[model samples]
Target: MSLAAPSETAPTTDSKVVVITGTSSGMGLAAAVAAAQAGWRTVATLRDPSRADALREAAVDAGVELDIRRLDVTDEAAATALVDAVIADYGHLDAVINNAGAGHLGTLENETVADVREVMEVNFFGVLHLSKAALPHLRASSGRLITVSSVGGVIGQPFNEAYCAAKFAVEGYMESLAPVAAALGVTVSVVEPGAVATEFVNNINLDRDAEVAAAGAYAPTLRAYLERTAAQFLNGAQTPAEAARTVLEALTADTPAFRLQTSDWARDFTAIKLTDVDGSAVLGLTGTWIG
Candidate 1:
């Protein structure tokens, strides 16, 4: 991770400060570099700065400097402190990208309630802590607060009970807060990406034979779902930089949309729920994945 020198310690006139989380890999990493290249005083944050090699390399290759910081979004205190430090360092805080999240791969019956809670803590509560900490500063600067949500947030899928539930909460929260935040001069938006290749698929733990064998009565359905999922990833998944582009759009757009889908496929997939008069459309579609 590159540290700023005394002369470059403060933000230059051309640099707009933006903090991005989960940048050790995937979209977060790409978004951080994109932000810096786009002339932002980018703060590339991760739970452990030791894993920042990829992020650092990307920044260097892009010929941009980044302020790498440690931020565990799950910690409310740490979120506040990080925001405070950013404000103190740069003299003014701008935007904050809440991209730190984890994926869970268990159905309710197969996993404990604690498993679900842990998912919520990272995917939902982590966003909450960071967003809450940054709202005031964002309001003052009239800056953007973007989140990296998923298509799972809109339409539910098999074996993603905990993951979808957390994303649903995130989308619901941001959708509701958009107008209120707008009233106070802060732009709030959620970028939903579908089948983002290795961006999230890599984070999921899915050992096919091991999982299906232990799945008990749900074995057959789980196997079908797994097979279908693997095919989707191997065949049509998008790159992390592709998804990160959407995040950058949200952060930099003049009048950013409240809900943004990364690709046309994502828009159409989520459109199923948008036009769904009844829940049957969504359920009918996802039902085929396991059946």
Candidate 2:
């Protein structure tokens, strides 16, 4: 199905214009639909519009419309142009959801520096590019800036060093910017989700066999960690829709929080840091995964 052309006419309403990145599938797709249902003029963007069939189908199935556009967060020019086009077309921009991210797995030694840089480019610098581009428009509207971080941001896990590093950077970047943005009336928030069953997990760019083979003495532990992670997905995982609701809540809350976890499990998991300042609690838990 072909997506509607990017709208040039400004939508009429007390239109809360929200731009969500990575809407080809998963939480981004769900968030775009949910935001539209909640009466926002939702601009759902993805790197490839050809891959947006699922998003379009879902929106049609739910009887909501999305202003779908092509946006590759990794391309600085495209990122800037997309935001400029959104404001130019819609006349106002209220919220920007930095949901465009890629997942990585494997130890630092197993993955190449190129691999680490690729993940960071999408997961960390992508947020920076889009957020920086949208800040002026957001400031003009006293808008919301929400980025979808992971529970791994606060607590590291085995074989997720690069992914966790990027998320941790996202959390830090937003946390540091939140107070300053608040001074200008833009509320910044980070949503941390645990084990959501989405393409985000299925599409992780990892070669487990290759990683395990390269591990040398760490092979057994790497295999065990992979098995345990698979079990976690089977036993406890949120739906993309459930995760999207958290994003929606963050966008529309009367007084939005600086950080939000999508599930009670996520909250409890992240609480390890707050409950224990030494960081031993999370470290000890992660250690068990390797053993």
Candidate 3:
């Protein structure tokens, strides 16, 4: 990924090149469209490009074109190859949105460690692989690196041990990298969103009845957690488009913050954990989620 020199470029309200993953749906799709609309040379990527119909339709409707490609973020080789290709074709990569992840709903007692590893491979390592592969190019362009994390990253939730652990890993990794990356002329930011209206839940592919049947002593607590979580998503979820706005801001801002929350609710939810010294506040708040 050696380059001639750093240059001001592509999507951040410029013709700068930006690569976004998981754009087949959700915030990824919306952010890809918004970046294109904002005058970026946007590369929208997904695990399977064949499922890009909705992304294509959205582009056509928005009257903005995008370079859609296949990118399984979990594959380090695939990530590096696409990045090299983007650099060769576009000349520079000014920003990246790491948003490719599947949903997982399980507790350690009910699921094997293999399940947790699979979740980490996508949610945590996926971001790591793509971001690592793109670092040289981003440094060459003094670019922005943003990831769409969840509030779960900040607050551990019941029945979501694997997902929360992975996201927490992402947040910690990025937080530690921010200062080091900043010195290298790259901006790193993590955007945390609360529950959003998207296919994220359905994408988990969980069979509630089967999971409950296998829960043994933990079935009742799991049921309560599931019910509460469903009601929250049903009654108080933000739109993917709404969440995408924060990601866009992180892309183009002259001086973006190291951390951002998609909504006020997300801000408040994470605040409890941030300000909690003894973990009592976070525990008290998350405790009611299952009760």
Candidate 4:
């Protein structure tokens, strides 16, 4: 990937600095460019800087520049070092966007313990590592801690046991931390998006046929769920740009909401749990997908 430098006008002392992870593609890449265009000194990090072509092209097209860096959020040392380096370069770390995550699609019977662990490592523990590394700097700057969660975080879906588990952990972690972070002058928020039209589906770490063959009694339900999910994606899925805009809103809002959804569909889907503690609303709705 080409590493394009920022415009000739380098970031000034007063320019706000924001770090976003997993900007190789999808919403993270869009958010990085949007943030830069919005006058932020954007530090866009990816697991492999070599995969930053799309992000660099988008930044160039937007007539903005990103301080692209290599960061694998799973590495605690790397996460801490990146935060330290950003603070040293920008004088203050203003915000951290934990957009780095992976998707898993399989039941416990089809997925090994290691598979579950890998999903949690990227989707859940990655957030924890980056947040812990940046918390002190964020407190010092009254910064924002925004994460791109999924509708799955709020409502568990069929065949997404591991992914939903990880996202649920993230929502719980952020919701619980919001008040404490507020007391320390740092804002914490989670952005949940539903069926985004991105490479996420293509990038899911699962072999559908293999999973179905191994599912035994669960094969029919798993197949039905997958077919329905594909239909939903085809019918109407929010664009990555739309989701990125929500991330920007969460980052720039004066009084940011603790939990935000990118689209009305997501909000309505998540609202079921809030309105019905018994979870019958969401459970019944999801059951239709498997049937």
Worst 10 residues of 2 by lDDT: 1-10
lDDT by residue (tens digit), candidate 4, 253-286:
8888889999999899888877888888888998
Identify the leading candidate in terms of lDDT: 2
Structure candidate 3, residue pairs in collision: 9-16, 10-15, 10-16, 10-17, 11-16, 11-40
lDDT of 1 by residue, 1-21 (tens): 234322124445356789898
TM-score of decoy 3: 0.94
Cα TM-score of candidate 2: 0.95
- By lDDT, is 1 or 4 better? 4
TM-score of 1: 0.95
Per-candidate alpha-carbon RMSD to the true structure: 2.2, 2.2, 4.8, 1.9
Clashes of each: 0, 0, 6, 0
The 10-residue segment of model 3 with minimum total lDDT is 1-10
TM-score for predicted model 4 compared with the true structure: 0.95
Clash pairs (backbone) in predicted model 2: none
lDDT of 2 by residue, 1-291 (tens): 124743323455468999999998989989998999998989889988788889888888888878888888999988889888877777889999999889888777666999899999999999999999999999999999999999999998888899999999999999999999999989999999999888987778567787778889789999999889989999999999999999999999999889999999999999998788888898899999878
